[model samples]
Target: MAQRLQSISAVTVSGALVIVLLLTLTFGTLGAVAFRADSLSGLSTRDWAAVRFTVVQAFLSALLSVILAIPVARALARRQFWGRSVLVTLLGAPFILPVIVAVLGLLSVFGRNGLLSQALGFAGLEPVSIYGAHGVVLAHVFFNLPLATRLILQGWLAIPAERFRLAASLGFGARDILRHLEWPMLLAVVPGAFMVIFLICTTSFAVALALGGGPKATTIELAIYQAFRFDFNLSKAALLALAQFGLCAIAAVISLWVSIPAGQGAGLDRVVARRDGSRILDFTVLLLVTLFLITPLGVIAVKGLGSVLSLPASTYGAAGRSVCVALASALLTIALTLPLALLAQRVSKLIEGVGYLSIAASPLVIGTGLFILVYRWADPVVLALPITILVNAAMSLPFALRAIAPALAEVERDYGRLSDSLGLTGMARMRLVILPRLRRPLGFGAGLAAALSMGDLGVIALFADPDSATLPLAMYRLMTAYRMDDAHGAALLLLSLSLLLFWVFDRGGRVNADI
Candidate 1:
């Protein structure tokens, strides 16, 4: 019965995606027509500025985030200190924190009247503007640093202790030990993390738009948004979207082409010296990085306190809609992803690679494709919230796989032999066994989908109307109008929603023994 339900759910989900793809293709064509020939023409000086600014900002953001993460990650990996788990989990908060929320916090602390400004009050010294190119870089770093730290920490943990032990036994110093084992781990993880951060920065819309302060610092995503929203230049937006897609495609190709060592087959049980010569350095770096990463949230909390009650009823309405949409999307995402995951597991190892491909494709690109499809059928794609849910689910599939694949592997390893011995195969075995065993992964994936959908500004940014806005869209709207207080309030709400959903789903996964 469970297997039958799984099969049915999978079919339904695939069918929904097909419809979504068809709708998006239509929207893309219409957008193309709306943009016209001139929109697709060669770059203007403004375009050149945007292109240059985007590349530099993204490259720097990726580089800085990864570089700053190494020490923090090393500390987390090496020390079994108090509050380690809390710190590790806190790193994940920024992942779900709304861009507007982080921006607001950054502005409150780093802006002219910000806390730091008051601290460094000097005659003839002006306040630092958390706006323009600097602001964009700051926001990107804020968002990506924790993520990079976590990724690199995992890499650091993957190194066998035996390698470190061997080094210690050979009288190798800390520097020598790092050169041999740690450097290899860094080489393997840094590029991949950089690629992830770069891809995120490439499609950055809210951060650029809110912090950009003008035309000078616009990213391609911002340019596209401006063309569509401000100028009503659909052709321009369409052309820019095409360009953005091309660039992302090239980046994705390059990332895959670069050969990096995988984490697999690493020694797991090499005992290394816990006390190292670099302890002081590692502690200081960890302290600094943690403070930097957490400061934005702290500022938000301080600044946002007064504005919570000032939020209008509309904000609450939008929040409700966002919750509903996220919940629906989570369920639908799990429904669709489970079948695909199972199919991949059953067919070939290569099928598993699809998960990573989905990860590399920014949410905005997928949203664009679906938006293009939506326009073919009608005027307001925003009215079709059901379709939005499906798209959100598909978008979350890559992360879902990351969360579930390991558990799925373990389940297969433990149960495969038993199922075969019992003469159980195909639908019967899957229904009676596999689906039940997969409950934990399903819950984890569902929660992740819900949490991600809760905070998404991409698809809704393209399709949202006055009446159709979700929480993130509402928050962006507030920011665009320079309603910092309202935006801050909304950001807090969104952040809470994301974290709560994530916690709920994660707990479900844990109870079910998925991870």
Candidate 2:
């Protein structure tokens, strides 16, 4: 009974994803048909500038993320301190956190009147510009560094304990051991991490749109938004969207090629014979990562606290809307993602790859495709909120799959035959047998989906009207209007909401169902 329901849910989830992909592809095909022949002729100097800036920012963001990850990955690999697992889990949160929320936290710390500014004021030093290209880079690093750190750490963990034991037994020096074991792990993970960060930065609209001070800082995604929303230049927006797609598609292909297999055993506990390394190098690495990871957050918390009372009533309303949107998106994302995870588990590897496609594609790209589709059918697009929820759910699919797949696999491996023998088949099996056993993964996936949707500004930016703004979108408006106080308050609220949702969902997932 349970098996039968699982099968039905799995098929339904897979079908939903297929319908979405088809819609997106259909839009892309129409876009190509209408715009491809004329895109070159319509390209402007400003479009060229935006394209160049986008590429440069993404490349630099990727480079910095992977380079900075080296040490944190090393520390995480070598040390097993108190709260280490908690810290590792926290590192993964940024991947799910909305870009706008991170940007808010970043601004509260790094902005002109941010905490840093106040601290530097005492010494008569000016606060650095946290707008334009610089802000985008900082925000990108904040989000990507932790992700790269985790990925590289996974690679380090994959090295067999026997190899480390042999090295220790042979009295291998730190340099020799690193050259043989550490370097290999680093090399394998770095390129793929870089590519992921690069793809993310490439499609960034909120960060660029909010922080981009002028013509100088525009990214391609921002260009598309401006062309469509502000200027009402559909043809040009369509043209730029294609350009954005081409660049992202190439980057995605390269990223997928270099990506390491998403195996279940990678994050599991492993034993490695410990060896002494240069204390100086270890300390330096730890310090750099700590400063990079925690400082901005600290900055935001302090500054946000100072300005919290000054926030406007409208900001509060926006916060409420954001909460509703995040919650709805999270729920929708989990409901949709469950079946996709099951499909990935049950279907051929090739079809499983289709389930993983959301990672390689950005939210802006997906949203663009949807926009084209909607504009075809409706003049004003009445279903913006539902559409935003749907798109956010789809965007959250990769993270949802990553969180759920391993646990599902583990459950299947251990209980497949037992369940079958017990005559567990459809919905009965899922409710009675599978759900109880898979609570942890389900909760984790739910938390991730909620957190990611909370932090997201991509689809919301496209769909939100002035009266229908989510927190992230409202915060962007504040920043652009130079309403620093309001922006700070909203930023703090968004950050708290995202973290709280993540924590609740994560804890919820841990609840036992009496297996």
Candidate 3:
């Protein structure tokens, strides 16, 4: 009994540590940045403009992403043609894809000299420019559309076959089906999906940096970066960071109230046999979505092959560093997530909310805070990689927790008494009972964290000196230098590494996850 009590205490303490770490890294950094803000000047016109642009873009991005995703997700759920599984799997790529790489891909598709422009030029039309607020919204849609599709698709798949059958037998038309079956699922899932994507777009830094920076285009996070990096105006940066935090906090609060719906009333594990939609429409929706998402990737692969053989050693070194950081971040995420997951509900709800705040918090804001906190005692450059790892892990915490926490809870609920009666506690219980059951989510969450960290360009860009640059940062520098060939090659490499890291961990988890 004493040993079991000690084990439980240790788990509780570790969970508390995870909460403390999240608080210190998130709000603690925000607080440090706050102290440096110039209260007298407040936000300039440019600052307020950035703030408005940020909110508008995020709202538009989320709205459009969810709206477009409905048809695509419905098409996917209804159709099971060849390569369907592959198509579904690929939908997840944009989530882990490097932001710099994604920007490059977007440029290749929609830039003034890109395919769209070329087609227009062939028709003797003017070239369309992708360099402002519209471009930012477009890029965000590219990233979030797939996410929205997957979420809504999951909802569609959860609709029991009986529901569709019953509707069909009752002579339900498309309108009738939408009213009875689809509307409920969309109502339950779409709000959560929109809020999640909204929060994501609100904290965007790299997308705005690459495609939007004019008076009407700059986001709050981008403004913070400009103040810190170009102007060397720490006060302005701090103030902008505070604004960004307020925006995210508001969005997070809204998201909290908008809970992602749980699985609807379960059916006898059956595939939904959807029949209301037209085959032509379904096929067209699938094809358009595939082309939109895949063309950029195809361009990357083709363009990258020509220059990958000649990439500079510096790029390789940066890649190596990114890999190291990714691995470290993955391990740290797993460690922190496990304890936090194990101790869920036993810990304070406020602490859990703090852990999730990382989702809404800007990585740039966190990095800036860290620089401020560390500058008083240590070299920020020297701590760049470490801070990147810590921040990346924190940035990934909400997703990991969402994935792993429920699974851990389910395992503990099912086996708690069994383990206790068998005298299995501490390492023995974790290893023999909890872990085997948790392999799927653990591996998946770890993979997600690793891939995200590998492709992370946010915090590293803030703190990295030349020597400490990650591949995404180095790739961005190359792009800025007009080294298109090298940038494309580096992007391909980063994409491959991100995908591979995710695959390895995800596959490892599923290999024997039938427990």
Candidate 4:
């Protein structure tokens, strides 16, 4: 019975994988159909400019983020001080943070009437503008720096304690440590990190639209938005979507190729206790990096406190809609991800790769393709909320898989044979053994999915009508309309909800949980 059940499970999972593949292929087909004879000929001087600007800014953003993360990661790795754990937790906040909220926070610190401009004026220096390419890069760096630091810090933690002890005994100095211990890890980690950030920035829309200043800083994503939303040119949008798809696919392939395993192991609790790094240098790096990261969030909190209550009834309506979408997306993401992750334990690499297809495919491309595909058969605007939910869920699947796959594998490995011997098969085994054992990862994955869905602005921007605007879109409208007070209040509310959702689910998973 157990053998039969296992066979049935495998077959079911494989069929699910095929459905996912077919769904992805449909995007390509629809995109191809949407392309017109003059789609390529439709490319204007401004379109080419957008293409150039997109690649340039993404490369610069990735480069600066990785280069600066090294010292910060090293500093955190070597130093054990008060609030280190809190700081490490804070490092993860930016990854799941709402892009629009982060933009507002950044504007509070770097905008024309911001603190930095005022300080520069007082010091008799020219007040700088946070617009154009520089502003886009700054925002990208703010979002990605913490991600890079966490990745590299994991690399540092993965280094064996024995190696550090031996180096210390051999009288290895900081330079020696750098040459032997740190450099190799950076070589392994930096490329992957750079490629990931580059891919992320390539598809950025809100940051570019808000801070790109004008067409001078427009990215391919912004171009796609313009073609679809402003010009209502489906063929041109399809062509631009194809271009963005190619860019992301190439970056994703390179990222996967150069990616190190992030050194996941059991010895992280055993600290290396390095004797090489300079105390003064580590302190300075830690201080500056912390301030750079925390200041924007602080600005949001301070600015939003007074304005929160003054937000309009429409803002609350948008918030309610956003929460519903987030909840539905989170549930759907886990439903799709869990089965695939379970199958991944025994499936081929190709099957696993299919699960990650959404990562390499631009959200705008997916939205555009789906819009074209659905428009032929139904009213696209009426289905806008549902489509947004589906796209957000798909976008969050990769993260959900990352969170749950390992735990699923471990559970099956540790208990599979035991369950079989005990005549535990199918649902009985899952309820009594699997669910209990997998709660932490399941909770964490669900939390990440929920938070991510709540903050997403990409796909919905393409599909949503004015009446269906999610909170992020609504907040964006407020900003564009120059309602700074309402925008800041909405930003605060969104920020709080995202963090709260993450905390609730993540903490729920850890509570009374068996390691």
- Best prediction by TM-score: 3
Clashes of each: 13, 16, 0, 0
Q: Of the pair 2 and 4, which is ahead by lDDT?
A: 4
lDDT of 1 at 226: 70
lDDT of 4 at 498: 91
Between prediction 1 and prediction 2, the one with superior TM-score is: 2
Stretches of candidate 1 off by over 4 Å are: 1-42, 122-124, 262-271, 354-357, 381-384, 420-431, 512-515
Best candidate, lDDT: 3
Q: What is each predicted model's overall lDDT from 0 to 1? A: 0.73, 0.74, 0.89, 0.84
CA lDDT, candidate 1, residue 238? 60
Regions of model 2 farther than 4 Å from truth: 1-37, 115-127, 260-270, 306-310, 376-381
lDDT of 4 by residue, 1-515 (tens): 75657855764665486456436644564455356315567788888888889999999999999999999999998888899999999899898999999998899889987889999999998878888899999999999999999988988888777667768999999899888877887888889989999999998888997899477898998999999999998887887887788788899999989997644234435666666768999989989988998898898898889999889988889899999998898888777876676666655545556667888777788888877777889988889888888888888888888878788888888988898788876567767887788789878888998898898888889888888889999999999998988888999999999988888888888887875
Candidate 4 lDDT score relative to the true structure: 0.84
lDDT tens per residue, model 1, 1-515: 55545655664566456434433433444344344525445456676577678878999999999998888888888777778789898898787676767777788789877777777776556667788898899999999999999989888877777766767789887788688778877888888888878877887777887788466788887777777667766556666666676667677776666537755466777545476667778778878877887887776766667887789889989999999999998887766566556655655656556545544444555555455555668674545466567667767777787766676677778887887677666577767777777777777788778887888777677677778788888887887788888877787778778889888986876684532
RMSD of 4: 2.5
| lDDT tens per residue, model 3, 72-169 | 99899878799999999889889998888989988888988788999999999998988999999999999999999999998998888877877889
Sort by lDDT, best first: what order?
Answer: 3, 4, 2, 1
